[model samples]
Target: MLKKLTQSETLAEQAYREIKQAIIEGRFSPGEHLPEEAIASMLGISRTPLKKAIEKLSYEGLVDLRSGKIARVAEYTPNDIENFLQLRVLLEPFNVEQIVRIPISEEKMSELVELVEEQKKAIEDNDLYQFIQLDAEFHLSLAKLNPNQKLQQFIEQLNNNLHRRYLILSKTLEYGSKTAYEEHVSILKALQKGNPEEAGRAMKTHIQNVENRIRGYQASSLH
Candidate 1:
């Protein structure tokens, strides 16, 4: 399977996905060094592909590459987190507006609903990782419901940068999942009503709630 993938995808693409998944799941903690040789050995691939993957992740702002040194996960400052949240506030509302004009299918909408429900179950099970992953998917799916490649690219990039920070915050905030599920319900309801304005408002508030909860977590973490 790995060799077949290498023929189609450069070894770098495979390495990139593996490294990115590790970062998202908190296996590679933020600010931890990413030794190319170590990763290459673990993935059972060559250093060339691992190096390529590190370069790609660095370009996406998910990892930092020091000159002549190993790559590491990017550190999130309070300002970095705030900036990410602000960008989502600015761009995603517009994306939601655009999606509202298109005819969204019932099946897809149900998928979004199920995503929220899945998060609820994950929360109940104390599975923070799955909750965070599903939470991101729910929001991204909304932006992707429309056929705008540019918007999709932008959101994908934004989510990559912000996803780790969200995972950290999720561990500290017990109410995060339930609150997110409720907000998602509101957004879905607006979509069902075919009301773009309401949907947009719900999304903005949902994102802002994430910001608010993250801020609270930061404050608590300080003590």
Candidate 2:
């Protein structure tokens, strides 16, 4: 059963989160029309809050809204996946390069190490949702090393768009969590060594590996 939102200062935000989680968990399949009235009733909210939630989801690329048509879950193609991956390859390495230029505090380094260890445990337990969240945190933590707020925002937006894609791929691909954890370890090790170039290279390779996996999955699905 769908859960009702508690009375809050940000009802729209709450609605957005619930709907987004439903989409991520495959409760709403790709390209299926989102029955706004049904969902609003299920969540015990009015269409106004639900509409606001849908708008935010659309901005995040998780929902499609068009003129004279109902909103549906966004369907991503292989080309769309490749394009997003390519953008990450270009943007994330540059963020790594910036991290190398700056000095990382001992406390921050310790926090990053802890996150990796927690992620390893998540993988061991086969907790896909926790693992995916930690994966985003790991990269976003590094991206935050950049001094530029604009760059950080850009990275955040990109990750938000990719979150659903990652969730879907993780379910379909057997090696998704294991390989991602291993690659994350490699990137962290390079960062620990203060090797910017090596860290950048590691990040680039990680993104490329993910791209390849997604492309391979798409091909297999078509066969």
Candidate 3:
């Protein structure tokens, strides 16, 4: 079955997906060196495909690849996540505030409504991966309502980085996916009501709560 799936994709693409999944699942620990030979041997592929896969992961910020250096899974510490969240605290809240002020169109509004509904269903089904995916979608869709292309791209990068880090911590952190979904619903409600103050406040609070959850976990773990 796996072979059949690989048939539709190049060896490099398949290797990329496999390695990426391993990194996200914490099978490949952060800063873990990935020797090309061993990874190629494990995946039953040649070094060339494995190298290409590592480079792709490098581009996505999941792997660190340098010429003449062995690839290592990217290390994102709590401080690193806090850095991303800090920027997000600035950008995302402003984006959503502008979105609320402009008053999103019905079409875009409906898109958000559908995304939150899907998010709720994912949580009910206990599908963490799907829920994470929808969480990014919800934030990105809201950012897309803004007309500034650069702003949209910037916000997308922030969201993607946060999403990837979230996946790495997934195994250790049972950080209430439902809490996030509920916060998203709060932001959406403010948008629906065309209240920029409430929307911005809700967005800010949601981002702040993310930092709180991570810190809370880290604190508990030290004990």
Please name the candidate that would achieve the greatest lDDT relative to the true structure: 2
Clash totals in order: 0, 0, 0
What is the lDDT, from 0 to 100, of the residue 3 in candidate 2? 92
What's the CA error at residue 100 for candidate 3, in Å?
Answer: 1.8
When 1 and 3 are scored with lDDT, the better candidate is: 3
Model 3 has an lDDT value of 0.80
Q: What lDDT does candidate 2 reach at residue 75?
A: 81
Alpha carbon RMSD to native, model 3? 2.9
For candidate 3, lDDT tens digit of each residue in 1-223? 1121255789899888778667654578778899988888788888988888888878777888888999898766776777888898999889998988777999989989999999999888877657766887888898889998999999998767655655455332246688888999999999999999899899999989888887776787689
Which segments of model 3 are wrong by more than 4 Å? 1-5, 166-174
RMSD of each: 4.7, 2.8, 2.9
Estimate the overall C-alpha local distance difference test score of candidate 1.
Answer: 0.75
What TM-score, over all chains together, does every model reach?
Answer: 0.74, 0.84, 0.84
Model 3 TM-score is: 0.84
Cα TM-score of candidate 1:
0.74
Write candidate 1's Cα lDDT for 128-214 as tens digits. Answer: 657767877887787688798888878877876565445453443344768877888898888888888988898899889888888
